[model samples]
Target: MTRIVVVTGGTSGIGRAIAERFAADQAEVFVTGRHADTVELTAKELGVHGVVCDATAPGQVSSLAARLERVDVLVNAAGGLPETASGDVAPLNALLAQWHSSLAQNLLTAVLTTAAVQDRLTSGSSVISIGSIGAERRGGSYGAAKAALAAWNASLSAELAPRGVTCNVISAGYIADTNFFRGQMSDERQRTLVEETHNKRPGTVDDIAQTTCFLASPGARHITGQAIHVNGGAFTTR
Candidate 1:
C-alpha cells in the first residue's frame, strides 16, 4: 500500500530531504512550506503534493489537516533558529522574544501540527519530530525548546504507543548544506563544529533523511519515545 506522508517545512534543508526520501519510496507525499511559490516549486520538482501553510498558525495548520484524510507518517520537520534568538536586541526584550520565538518555532510547531493531525494518523503510523544537538549544549533558547520537544515526544509516545503509533525525536548535530546557517556561520565556527565530532565531519541531510525513513518503517515499530542521536558522535549518551 502506498503510504500517505505529511512533511511540514518540506521546501528546503532537512525537511526537504525527508520529503524526498519518502517520495523515493513511492509514498504519496504532501509537503508544506510557508511560501506558496517555494511549495509549488518543490512539489513540482519532487513529484509530490505541496501545500502552503505555516505550521505555527492555527488556521493554516487546520487547513493543512483538512486536506489530509489519512496519514501514515507525520514528520514534524518545521522549526528553526530565528535571528532574534541570537541577534542584538534590548537585553530584556531579547530574552523574552528569543524564548518565545524558539518555543513557537521548535516545540510548538510539532505540538500543534501533531494535534491537528492526530485523528488521521493510522494505527501503525510514525510521528517523527526533528530535534537538535543544541538542546544538549550551547543551544540557548532554541536548545531549550528542542529539549522541551523531547519531553513532549515522550508523552506523545506514551499516548500513541498503545495505538501502535510510534512517536520519536531525532537529535541532529551540525549539518552542512541548506540555508540553516543563513550564511552567518563563520568558517572558524564550522571547523570547530566539525572538529567536535568524532568523525571530524559535518552531517549530511541524507543522514537524517535515511534515519527518518527507517523509523517510519515497520522495523522501527518497537522504537518509540526515544531520542535517537545522529550527530556523528559529537555527543554521546550513556
Candidate 2:
C-alpha cells in the first residue's frame, strides 16, 4: 500500500524538501500550508495532495484529519521564528507577543495537529517533529519553544509506543539554502556557523529529510522518544 505521508508547513523550506523527498519515493503525500496559492503551487510541483490549513487552528486541523483514513507518517514541520510587527505597543506586551507567536508556531501547531490526526496513526506509524539546535544554546523564545517541542515528544512517545507508533524530534542545526533565517543572516554569521561545525559545513534539507524517512522505517521501530540532532557536530550529546 502507498503510505499516507502528511507534512505540515509544506509550502517551503524544510517542509517542502521533506514533501519532495517522499513524493520522489511514490508516497501518497499530503502537504499543508497557511496559504492557498503556495500550497497549490507546491502540491502541483511535487505531484502530491495539498491542503490550505493553519495547523494552529483546531477547526481546520479537524477538517484536515477528516480527509485521511490513515496517516502512516506525520511530519510536524510547521514552525519558524515569527516576524515581529512594527507596533507601538508596550515593551512587555511586545515581549509577550513574541513568546506567544513562537509557542503557537513551534509548539502548539505540533500539539494540535497530532491530537487531531493521531487516531489515524495506527501500528507502524511515526511522528517526526522538526526541532532546532537553538534549544541547546540560547535562542530566546524560539529556542524555548523548540525545547518544549522535544519535551512534548517525550510524553507523546510514551502514550503511543504501546500502539506501535513512534515519536521523535529531529533537532537540525544550521541548514544551508533555507528561508529559515528570513534573509537576515549576515555573511559573517553564516561563515561562523559553518566554521563551528565539525564537518565544516552547514546541514542540508536532505540530511533531515533522509533522517525523517529512516525514523519512519521499520528498522527505527525501537528509536522512539529521542531527539536526533543533525547539526554536523555543532552540538553533541551522547
Candidate 3:
C-alpha cells in the first residue's frame, strides 16, 4: 500500500530530505511551507504534493489538515530560529522577545499542527517531531522550546499509544547542508562542532531522514515517547 506521509517545513533542510526520501520510496508525500513559490517548487521537484501553510497559524494548520484524507506518518519539522524583531532595545526586552519567538516557532507550531491532525491519524501511524541538542546544552530560548517539545511528546505518546499510534522526538545535533546557520558559519566554528562529535564529522540530512523512515516502520512499533538523539556521539545518556 502507498503510505501517506505529511511533513511540515518540508521545503528545505532536514524536512526536505525526509520528504524526498519517502517520495523515493513511492510514498504519497504531502509537504507544507510558509511560501507558495517554495512549496510549489519543492513539491514539483520531489514529485509530491505541497501546500502553503504556516504551522504557527491555527487557521492555516487547520486548513492544511483538512487537505489530508489520511496520514500514515506525520513529521513535525516546521521549526527554526525565530526571526529577529525590534532590535536596539533593552537587554531584558530583547531576551523576552527571543524567548517568545522561539516558543512560538519551535513549540507551538508542533502543538497546533499535531492537534489539528490528531484525528486524521490512523492505526499504526507515527508522529515525529524534530528536536535539537540545544535542548541539552546552551540553547537558551531555542533549547527551552525544544525541551518543552520532548516533554509534550511524552504525554502525547501516552495518549496515542493506546490507539496503536506512536509519537516521539528526534533531537539532532550539528546537521550539515541546512540553512540553520544562515550561511554565517565560520570554518573554525564548523571544525569545533565536528571535533566535538566522537565520529569526527557533522550529521547529514540523509542520516536524519533514514532514521525517520526506520522509526515509522513496523520494526519500531515498540519505540514511543522517547527522545532519540542522532548527534553522532556528541552527547551521551545513561
Candidate 3 residue-pair clash tally: 0
* Per-residue accuracy of model 3 over 17-112 as CA lDDT, tens digit each: 999999999999999999999999999999999999999899999999998888899999988986676757998888788888899989998999
RMSD of 2: 0.7
**Clashing pairs in model 3?**
none
Using lDDT as the measure, the top candidate is: 2
In order, candidate lDDTs are: 0.94, 0.96, 0.94
lDDT-better candidate, 2 vs 3 = 2
TM-score, one value per model:
0.97, 0.99, 0.97
Q: Model 2 segments beyond 4 Å from truth? A: none
Candidates 2 and 3 compared: the better one by TM-score is 2
Please identify which of the two predictions, 1 or 3, would achieve the higher TM-score against the true structure.
Answer: 3
What is the RMSD, in Å, between candidate 3 and the native fold over all Cα?
1.0
Candidate 2: TM-score? 0.99
Candidate 2 local lDDT, residue 81? 98
| Best-matching candidate per TM-score | 2
Of candidate 3, the 10-residue stretch with the lowest lDDT total is: 82-91
lDDT of 3 at 131: 98
